[model samples]
Target: MDLFIRYILIGIGNGAVYAALALALVLIYRTTGLLNLAQGEMALFSAYLSWWFTTHGVPIGLAIAFSILLSMIGGAVIERVLIRPVTAPGKSHLNVLIVMLGMFLAINAISQLLFSTDAEPMPKPWPSVSSPGDPVGRSARLLDIGNTSISWAVGALALTLIGLCLFLYLLLQKTKLGLALRAVASNPASARMVGINTSAMLMVGWALAAGIGALAGSMVAADRGSVSPGLMTVVLVYAFAAAALGGFDSPVGAVVGGMIVAIAESLTIGYVDALSTIELVVPFALILLVLLVRPTGLFGRRVVERV
Candidate 1:
């Protein structure tokens, strides 16, 4: 039972990371009706920025903040300069997709060229606590439960996820900007007729998505203790699976789906010896099952359009 609880906690930790990425995916999908294949690469670039800052003696928290800000600006610029031109109403979706794919490859190459292909260790923002005798500090563990322990890093991440979720909920449900964004997303023509700046809202959506991706990437890199050009590839796959499983249009669905995926992956690897080598298959299988049973996703609404 203790072991099970430990695995569950660990799964939740991993799920938090997936949820962050899935949220970004859902944000982009909601606003543009398209997926940014380069989202993960954008995140990878932000992670590298954070690492670079830390290596230059900047505090980890400050470094992450700076990275997020830069990522948001970069996202806006990309949307304005690259994505916006190709994503006009009459433009082909394939063009935007191709651009995103090209960005994926370009960003990966840029990271390799600038930061090198070598993996670099990232310092944990929160300190770990190892034992009862350990002093409470940045390195101290949060708590010890039964035979298992939760480190400060995991605890901080969990808290951060909770905070982010609440902030998003409020933003989407209560803010004027959120309402405008939703209006634009629902019907750009009508939104523009009503005086909403659809283009600016689209830019905001991209910027917000990129900022969230930066956070997710930083957390993942910190957890793994290293960052590299391809750091986000596997994570990107899991995030896609989570977003699909939860209903690409639902933020709550994304979080729930991410948790489900992580828990399933954890249990499969921990108990199913034969599947240990292929644990990544678990998320994809879940995605297939969800699609077959409910194409709109577990929490996604079924859209009805008149012919």
Candidate 2:
């Protein structure tokens, strides 16, 4: 039971990381109706920037802030220069998807050329420079009287995710920019007709998504104690699964779905011996199961198509 609890805490932190990226995916989907396959790579690019800044005598806080800002600009530029070429009314969605695939290859190649494939340990941004240097279980403090205990890092991450979610919710609910984003998402043509700059809003959507992706990358790198060009490869799978489980178009669903997926993965790794080696497959299987039962996802709205 203690083991289970420990794994749950660790998984929760990981889930928050996945939730961050999944939120990015949800944002792009809501605005452009396309999945940005390049999200992880974009995150990797930004993380590399952060790592570079940190190595160049910059403060960690400033490094992260600068990295996020750069990523936002990169996202907006990509949307304008690359994505816009393939995106047109009544055009082929396949083309836009392919463009993103091209972007994935392009970014990966650029990273490899500039910053070799060698991975480096990412120093912690805060005082906790070293992981407690113990097994994740032993590193956590036991509860006074119960079998449950908490991991400090996990607790911190969960709190951060909650705060971010609340902020996003409030932003969407109370801000004019958020309203315009929603309008762009719900009906681009109408939004354009109403003097809303749909194209710019789409750019903003991508920029926001990229910024969120950068944050996710930074957290994952800190959690793992390293940064690599491929750092986001595995995490992206879990993020996609979380997005699918929650509802690709719903932010609240992303958070709930991320936590559920995290818990399920923890339980599976703890209880299913055969899954020990192929643990990563667990989330995909669950996503398949969920989609089989509810094609629209757990929190997705049903859509009717007219031919």
Please identify model 1 stretches exceeding 4 Å from their true place.
129-139
Clashing pairs counted in every model:
8, 0
Q: Which pairs of residues collide in model 1?
A: 127-138, 127-139, 127-140, 128-139, 128-140, 128-141, 129-140, 129-141
- How many clashes in candidate 2? 0
lDDT of 2: 0.82
Evaluate residue 234 in candidate 1 and report its C-alpha lDDT on the 0 to 100 scale. Answer: 83
- lDDT for each residue of candidate 2 in 1-307, tens digit (9 for 90 to 100): 7787777887898899889899999999999988889999899888877877888888766887898999999899999999998888778999998998898888977877776587866655543523465321122442333766564456656766887788778877899989999999888889999999888899999999998888778767766767787888877888888999999999988887888888878888888999897887888888899899998788987877679
Error of 1 at 201 (Å): 0.5
Candidate 1 structure quality by residue, lDDT tens digits, 1-307: 9878877888898899988999999999998888889999999999998998999989888999999999999999999999988977788899999999999999989988887689987877777434554322244567898778877767877887898899898898899999998888787889999999999999999999999999999988887778998899988888898999999988999999989999898899889999998999888988899999999999887888889
lDDT agreement of model 1 with the native = 0.88
Query: In candidate 2, residue 285 scores what lDDT?
Result: 87
lDDT of each: 0.88, 0.82
lDDT of 1 at 202: 91
Off by over 4 Å in 2: 129-149, 305-307
